[model samples]
Target: MSTLTDLRRSMVAEARRRQRLTWLISAVVLVALPWIFSSSFSISIMTQIGIAIIFALSYNMLLGQGGMLSFGHAAYFGLGGFLAMHAMNYIADGAIPLPVPLLPLIGGVIGLFFGFIIGTFSTRRAGTVFAMISLGVAELIAALSLIFVGFFGGEEGVSSNRTKGPDFFGFNFGPDIQVYYVAAFWALIAAIAMFLFSRTPAGRMANAVRDNAERAEFIGYSQRNVRMISFCLSGFFAGLAGGMFAIAYEIVTEETLNMNQSGAVLLMAYIGGVGYFIGPIIGAIIMTLLRTVLSNFTELWMLYVGLLFIATVMFVPSGLTGLLMMHGPAWKRRSLKRLLAPYAAISIPSLAVIMGVGGLLELTHFAHTTSMDDRVMTLFSIPMNIDSLLPWAGLIALFIGGVLGVRRLRPMLLDAWADANGAGGGD
Candidate 1:
C-alpha cells in the first residue's frame, strides 16, 4: 500500500513539473514572438491570432470538454464586442471612468448573464435539440440587431474609440504594438484560467456528463447543471475574446455576430483537434494565417480552406493535433525513425499532387473569369495563356503522374507504419 501511494505521488509530482515547464516555455515564446516579427502588419496579425486563440479555446470548453455542439457560439462573442464598444464609447463620453484594459470584464459579465439565461432552457436537452435551439437563438438575435438600430447600429453596427478610456500606467494604447501586448496578457490569463477550470471537479463532472449523462445522473450528479456551468464559462471566455476584438479594431459590426463567424470558430476548434487542450490554439494560429496570408495571395482562399477542412474530416477526423499525437507511441518505442524514409517518399508525390491541383484550379478560374485581353495567367511564376491547351495538358499530366506515384508508394508507407507500430515484419 505504501509503494502504491508513493508511485501515485511521484506521478502527480512529475505532472506538476511538466505543467510548470510548459507554462514557462509558453511565456518565453509569447514574449519573444513580437520581437521576432516586429513589423506593424505582423503585429496586427499576431493580435488577431491572440484573439482567435482565446475564442477557439472558449469554444473547445463547450464542444470538446462538455460535448456541446453550439452553432451560435459567435453570438456571445459578438454581443460581448458590441457591449464592450458601448462601454468604450461611454468612457469616451465621460459617462464612465473605467480603464480600457478592464472593459472586457463588462463583456464577460454580459456574456455570463446571457449564457445563464440561454443555458437554463438549452441545457434541459442535449445533442440535436440543443444545437437547434442555439441556432434559433442566434438567428433571433441577428435579426434583432438589424431591427434595433439604437444599439446594434443597424447594418453599420457599432464603433468605439478604445484610446478614450483612462490610461493604464501612463499608456493610452495608441499604437498597435501596445494593443498586442494587452491582448497577449489577456490571452495568457484566459488560457491559464480555462486550463485550471478543466482540472476542477465541476469540469470533471462536465466531462462525465459529456461521455455518459445517464451514468453521471445515476451517480447523483445533475448533468444539466454541469452543462450549464460549462456553457456559462465558455461564454465568459468568448465574450472576453470579443472584447479584445473591439479594442483591437474599435468596431463591432454585424459580421462579427453572423453565422460565418460562428462557423469559422467551429472550423478552427475542430481542425485544431478538440480532444486536446492545445489543439484549438494550433487551429487558431493556422486558420488566422490562412485567412490573412493566403487571402492576400489568392481569391480562391476560401475554396482552399473548404478543401482543407473536408480533407481533415475525411482523413484526419481526430484533427492535426490528433495526427501528431498518433506518433507518440512510436517515438516512445524509438521506432519513429524507421518511417522517415517512407514519409519522405510519399511527401514528394503528395506535394506534386497538391501543386497540380492548385494549378488546375487557378487555370480553370482564370479561363472562365478573365477577359480576352487578360488571357495571360501565372502558375509557379511561369506565364501561361488561359486560352491555350498546353498548360491544361501539362497540369493534367502532372496530376496523373502524381496520382500513380502515390499509389505505387502507398504500400511502402503502409509497411513502414505497420513496422513502426509493431504490426509488421520490417523493423
Candidate 2:
C-alpha cells in the first residue's frame, strides 16, 4: 500500500512537471517568434495565425467538447467584430473614452449574450436539429445585418481607427509589431483560459453530454444546460477572435460573417483534429499559411483545400494530430525506425501522385479557361503547351506509375507498421 501511494505521488509529480514544462516551452516560443522572424510580412502572418488559433479553439469548445456541430459559428465571430468596430468608431468620435485593447472584451460580451439567447433554444436539441437551427439563425442574422444598414453599415461593412484609442504605455499600436504583440498576449491568455475550462466540472459535463446525453441525464445532469454553457463560452472566445481580426485588418466587411467564413473555421477545426486541445492551433497555422502562400501561386487553391479536406476526412478522420499521435505507440516501443524505410518508399510515390494530379488539374483549368496566348504554362520549370498531348501523357504516366507503386508497396508498409506496433505478422 505504501509503495502504491509513493508510485501515485511520483506519477502526479511527473504530470505536474510535464505540464509546467509545456507552458514554459510555449511561452518561450511565443515570445521569441516575432523577433526570430523580424519581417513585416512574417509579423502579419503570425498575427493572423494568433487570431485563427483563438477562433479555432473556440470552435473546438463547441464541436470537440460539447459535440455541437455548428454550421454558423462565424455568426458570433463576425458579430463580435462588427460590435468592436462600432466601439472603436465610438472612441474615435469621442463618444466613448475606452482603450482599444479592451474593445475585444466588448465583442466577447456581445457574443456571450447572443450565444445565450440562441443556445437557450438550440441546446434543447442535439445533432442534426441543432445544426439546422444554427444555420437558420446564421442566415437570419446575415440577412438582418444587410437590412439594418445603420448598424451593419450595408454591404461595405464597418471600419475603425485603432490610433484613436488610449495608448497602452505610450504605444499607440501604429506599428504592426505592436499589434502582433497585443494579439499574441490575448491569444496566450485565451488559450490558457480555455485549457483550464476544459478541466472544469462544467467542461467535464459537456463532454459527458457529448458522449452520451441520455446517460448524462440519468445522473441528474441537464444536458441542455451543459451544452448552453459550452455554447456561450465558445461564442465568447470566437467573438474575441473576431475582435482581434477587426484590429488586425482595421475593417470588417460582409465577408467576415458569411457562410464562407463559417466553412473556413469548420475546416480549420476538422483538419486540425477536433479531439485534441492543440489540434485546432496546428490546423489554423497550416490553413492560414496555405491560404497566404498558395493564393499567390494558384487560383485553384480553394479546390485543393477542398480535396485535402475530403482526403483528411476519409483517411485521417482524427485530423493531422491524430496522424501524429498514431506514431506514439511505435515511438514508445522503440520500433519506429523499423518503419522508416517503408514510409520513405511510400512517400515518394505519394508525392508523385499529388504532383501528377495537380498537373492534370492545372492543365485542365488552363485549357478550358486561359486565352490562346496564355495556354503555354510552366510547371516545375517544364514549359508545356496545354494544346499538346505530351504533357497529358506524361502526367497520366506518372499518376499510373505512382498508383501501381503504392499498390505494390502497401503490403510492405502495412507489415512494417504492424511490426512497429507489436502486432503479430503472418508468414
Candidate 3:
C-alpha cells in the first residue's frame, strides 16, 4: 500500500512537471513567433490565428465540454464584435474613458449577458433540441442586424480605428506587432482561464451532464445549470475573441455574424478534436493558415477545407489532435520508429492523390473561369495547358495510381500500426 501511494505521488508530480514544461514551451513559442515571421503580413496572420484560437476554444466549451453542438454561437461573437467596434468609436470620440486593451472585457460582458438570456431557454434541453434553438437565435439575431441597421451598420458594417483609442503604456497599437502582442496577451489569458475552468467541479459536472444527463440528474445535479454555466463561459470567451477581431481589423461587419462565420468556428472545433483542450488551438492555427495563406494562392480553398473536414469526420472522428494522440501508446512503448517506414510508404500515394486532385480542380476551374487565351496554367511551377490532353492524362493517371497504391498498402500500414501500438506484440 505504501509503495502504491509513492508511485501515485510520483505520477502526479510527473504530470505537474510536464504541464509546466508545456506552458513554458508555449510561452517561448508565442514570444518568438513575431521575430520568426517578421513581416507585417505574417504578424497580421499570426494575430488572426490568436483570435481564432480564442474563438475555437470558446466553441469547444460548448461542443467539447458541454456536449452541446451550436450552429449559431457566432451570434455572441458578432454581437460582441459589433459592440466592441462601437466602443472603439466612442473611445475615438472621447465618449468612453476605457482603454483599448480592456475593450475585450466589454465584449465578454455583452456575451455573458446574451448568453444568459439565450441559455436560459436554450439550456433547458440538450442534443438536437438545443442545437435547433441556438440556430433559431442565431438567425433571429442575424436578421435583426439588418433590420436594425443603425446599430449593425447595415451592409457596410461598423468600422473603428484602433489607433484612435487611448494608448497602452507608450504604445497606441498603431503597428501590427503591437496589436499582435495585445491579441497574444488576451489569447493567453483566455486559454489559461478556459483550461482552469475545465478542471473545476462545475466543468467536470458539465462533462457528466454532457455524457449522460439522466445519470447526472440522478446524482443530485441540475444538468441545465451545468450547461448554462458552460454556455455563458463560452460566450464570454467568444465575445472576447470578437473584441480582438474588432481591434485587429478595425471593423465589424454583418458577415462576421453570419451563418458562414458560425460554420467556420464549428469546423475549427470539430476538426481540431473537441475531446482535447488543445485540439481547437491546433484547428484554429491550421484553419487560419488555410483561410489567410491558402486562399491567396487558390480560389478553391473553401472546397479543399470542406474535403478535409469530410475526410476527418469519416476517417478521424476524434479530430486532428485525437489522430496524433492515437500514437501515444506506440510512443510510450518506444516502438514509434517502427511505424515511420510504413507512414512514409503511405505518404507517397497520399501526396500523389492530393496533388492530382488539386491540379485537376485548378485546371477545370481555370478552364471555366478564364478566356481561351488563358489556356496555360502553372501548377507545381510547371506550365500546363488546360486545353491540352497531356495534363489531364497525367493528373488522371496520378489519381488512379494513387488510389490503387493506397488500396494495396492500407492493410500493411494497419498491421504495422497494430505492431507499433503493441496490439500485435503480445505485450
lDDT of each: 0.91, 0.91, 0.93
lDDT of 3 by residue, 318-383 (tens): 999999999998899999999999899999998999999999999999999988577899998989
lDDT string for model 2 (82-183, tens) is 999999999988889988877788888888989999999999978999999989998888888899999999999999889888757898877999888888
Spell out the clash pairs found in candidate 1.
none
RMSD of 3: 1.5
Identify the superior model by TM-score, candidate 2 or candidate 3: 3
lDDT of 3 at 13: 96
- Candidate 1 regions exceeding 4 Å error are 424-427
* Predicted candidate 1 versus true structure: per-residue lDDT over 174-219, tens digit per residue: 8999899888888898999999999999999989988998899999
Best by the lDDT measure: 3
Give the least accurate 10-residue stretch of model 1, judged by summed lDDT.
418-427
